[model samples]
Target chain A: MLDAFLGWTGVVFVFIGVFFLFLGALGILRLPDLLNRLQAGTKSTTLGVVATSIGVGLIVRGWILFAAALAVFLLMTNPISSHAIARASYRAGVKLYPGTHPDKCEERKWKLPEDGEEK
Target chain B: MRNDTPILVKKITALSLITILMVGFFWAFTEMPKGSSVNVNNRVSRLYILKNVKAATKSLNSGNFFAKGMKPLRSDVPYSPITFGKSANLEDGAANVVTSIVVDYRGFDTLGEVTVLFLAATGVAMLFFGKRKKNIIKAQASLIMSVGTRIAYAVILLFGIYIFVHGHLTPGGGFPGGAVIASGVLGLFLGNDHYESNHLGLKLFESLSGMAFVIIGLTGLFSVNSFLANFLPTGVIGDLYSAGFIALIYIAIGMKVGAELSAVVDSMIVDTEEEWS
Candidate 1:
């Protein structure tokens, strides 16, 4: 009974993972800006990876350790990668969307007149 | 003859070339036999699994083929293919056949591959080597990015070490693990201004590892009367210390690869990490 329940849960989790991945792929295709695409890609992919790995672990024998490790790595690295991409875009002077409000990082650049001044 | 060929002739030549390439690619893809389709039952892997660990048997291809060729190959293999992935666990006492094969069976090939990689790294470093200009200021990454990159770098380094350490028992091995380590250091070089690769540390790590690999091979030659023979004791299979020289060789490879890759990266980023004056 427990095995069946776990199997069913895995199936459901896999479906959910597929859904999130599909959404993320769509967002990547449709998103206007680089930041928007990265945001869509990272967040959804992280969650999708977690769900998919868990699903696979439940379905397969002796895969829990690998799944857990992969989840931990994805969780740790995804946001960090997104942050790096954002930083790269900003450094490259990529303009924000026209309709977007005032940017805080841009504002902070004006606030700090000299280098090594900001905490 | 005119300086230029006719447009019609040019088009025909291009078309013929494209058609030939496409046909060649398709023929190669379709006609070639897949490795997976081959009967594993006929392979030495089947026999390797059934028997207990022993000294390397002289194969028909290697030597003494005429006498040994008389006996029929074993058919009563106890375990199926599913249960036994590779005979490395039973015969060689190494869990990972990929490592065993790469570092043991085809070691000389791997040594040549390593040499090629080293030469490439050296050539790249030499090509990029020069005195630094004082005026070229590098822009620092954002605080959040810097912190995140540092954390990621640490995680990646740990993961690489783990990969190479468990190479004999796991899916990953020295080459991939070393690449992982290099990428992590590359992240540091990109994010941090003061992230200079220590020449002494890198050089010592690389050279010592290379020397250690050679020494082990030489010791095997002396001990077993063969190059890179299983000289060290093969402990019980599936343990960290089980694979003996395989693990040690992988560790050495990992260090050498990581150091060499770091040297390559350091060469690319001249201003940040310069060679000694």
Candidate 2:
């Protein structure tokens, strides 16, 4: 009885993870501007993957440790990688969405070059 | 415009070429034995799979062919089941069949592959040999990016070492392990603008590891009468110390590949004066 309940729970988790992954993909496609897309893509996908791996681990009890390790690794790396990309693009003069206000990068003494100057 | 052959002539040539190719393909296909008619027991790969090469060869060449009703074949030999942790004293003791084949059965091919990679790295390095200027990155990496890279590099390095060390028992091996380490080096490059790998150290390490591979092969030749033979005792399958020289060869390959690839990345990322022209 316990095994069956756990199995069903795992299946539901898997479905939820897949749904989130689909939403992330949709956001990547539909979101305007690079920074917003990066935010949507990274956050949703990280959550999606962690959920999916946990679900898989619950289903295959023997591989729980490996799945957990993978999840931890992903969690540590994903945000840093996204940060790197965003910093690089900003330096290269990718324009912010005009609606964005209170530009914080300028406060950090980051000189924004003209669009083609960085190249 | 240049004058072209007539359309009819072109059509005739193309048709003839197609006909010739089709005929050749059909001829080869017909010559090959198809489906269940072919006996796979006759293939050398069957011996490798069954781990019965020595025994099968002996049974076939035992010199009792005329007296027997039928000739002894490789398929006639009985093979015991290979358990993950229990099987021992095997001809090749690696738990992973792919590892056994690549390192034991066909090690020379792997050597050739490593050599090819070495040559390619050498060519790339030579092209960018002179004093290198830092490649321009418009902005500095953020504090989080730099700090996170340092933490991640340690973990990545540990994982790479684990992969190569456990090559005989697991799915991963030297090439992948080395690539993983090189990627960590690449992350280092991204995180720090001034960070440079020790060039002399990398070159020395790569050369020494490559030499170690050759020396091991030579040891096999001297002691066992064949190149890259499994000269050391293969312990129990799935054990850390198992698979005889496979682990040693993998370590050598992993180190060599890691150093060579790191050097290649270094050369590619740093700009040379020639690029300015």
- Candidate maximizing TM-score: 2
Q: Which pairs, if any, clash in model 1?
A: none
DockQ for every prediction shown: 0.30, 0.29
Ten contiguous residues minimizing lDDT sum, candidate 2 chain A: A110-119
Give the alpha carbon lDDT tens digit for every residue of A18-91 in model 2. Answer: 98899899999998889999998999999899889888988888888998999999999999999888877877
- Candidate 2 residue runs with Cα over 4 Å from true position: A1-9, A106-109, A112-119, B1-43, B58-76, B134-137, B273-277
For this target, which candidate reaches the highest lDDT against the unseen true structure? Answer: 2
Write out the backbone clash pairs for model 2.
none
lDDT, candidate 1, B9-113, per-residue tens: 988988999999999999999987797785544556644443332321534444432344434343222343323333344446677777777787777787788
Candidate 1 lDDT over residue span A1-95, tens digit each? 98889888988888888889988999999988888888889899889889999898887748988998888888877887788778768777797
Please provide TM-scores, in order, for all candidate models, with all chains considered together. Answer: 0.78, 0.80
lDDT by residue (B1-277, candidate 2, tens digit) is 1258788888888899999999999999999997768764445565676665677667658743223444234435554667878888889988887889998889999999999999999999988988766556555566797899999999999999999999998998999999999999999988875687898999999999999999999999999999999999998888999989999999999999999999999988877777434
Any runs in candidate 1 off by more than 4 Å, and if so which?
A: A104-119, B1-37, B41-91, B128-136, B272-277
Error of 1 at B35 (Å): 7.6
